[model samples]
Target: MAALAATDSADLEKLLLEVCSSPSWAADVAASRPWSDRGALLAANAAAMARLTTADLADAMAGHARIGSPKAGDATSEREQAGIQGVDRALLDELHGANAAYEAKFGHVFLICATGRTAATMLAALRERFPNDPATEAEIVRGELRKINDIRLGRLLDEPS
Candidate 1:
């Protein structure tokens, strides 16, 4: 916590941006630094995420690849969504179609914290959320984004140990 709190501004922003890709979110989290512990830092991240405007949320969502592709997204996404790869072909195809419908409806990728979730479970979730209203779906996306951030932040802070 001390090391992250004491990091230089440029480095900190870069790191935070890698986690969520929203400039404002990163900036806000960075601004709220000097956290006393991991819990405090995580709280700052959640608060910053909550403060995001719709546009900012979209900007962060842009950083993620569409779910269920043959490939996972960026390196971090690759690790977080590792379970989606090498699944049954039928399942993968279904996910691809669901992703298309989701993007067509929401104008953004279907964001989920894929860590620890099996492909079937994620696919089921995607199907379930397909009928959600925009406002509700946005809330779901925000929650998923928060989960991903929490995991990534843990990784970021754990690096030195």
Candidate 2:
């Protein structure tokens, strides 16, 4: 927390963008710095998430890869989506189709906190959320983004100062 608070503004915003892709979110978190603790930082994250416009949230979601298809070089997505790795090919194909259906329905990638969750669980969630109206899905997306950001923030703080 101390190290992040002490980081220069541009660098700090860059780091925060890794946690959340939205420039507005990164800037908001950066500007609200000097966090007293991890909890305070998370609170700021939640507050910033709440302030995001629909378009801003879409921008943030754009940073994330579709579930079951973690980008090749993205360690964060690879680690978070580990459950999808080495799974049955049939299951993977199913997940891929579901991902397409989700994107078609929501007009954005399906966002979920995949850390500690199985591919099956994520698939179930995607199917369940498939029926939601845009407004409800957007709200759920914000919550999922919050969870992903919290996990990434924890990892960032764990890095050597």
Among the numbered candidates, top TM-score falls to 2
Looking at model 1, the pairs that clash are: none
Clashes of each: 0, 0
Model 2 — which ten-residue stretch has the worst lDDT?
Answer: 1-10
**TM-scores, all models, native as reference:** 0.95, 0.98
Which runs of model 2 end up more than 4 angstroms from their true locations? none
What lDDT tens digits, residue by residue, belong to model 1 across residues 30-74?
999789899999999899989999999998998887776524335
Per-residue lDDT of 73-108 in model 2, one digit per residue for the tens?
Answer: 989989999999878998899899999999998899
- CA RMSD for every model? 1.5, 0.7
lDDT of 2 at 60: 99
Work out candidate 2's RMSD over C-alphas: 0.7
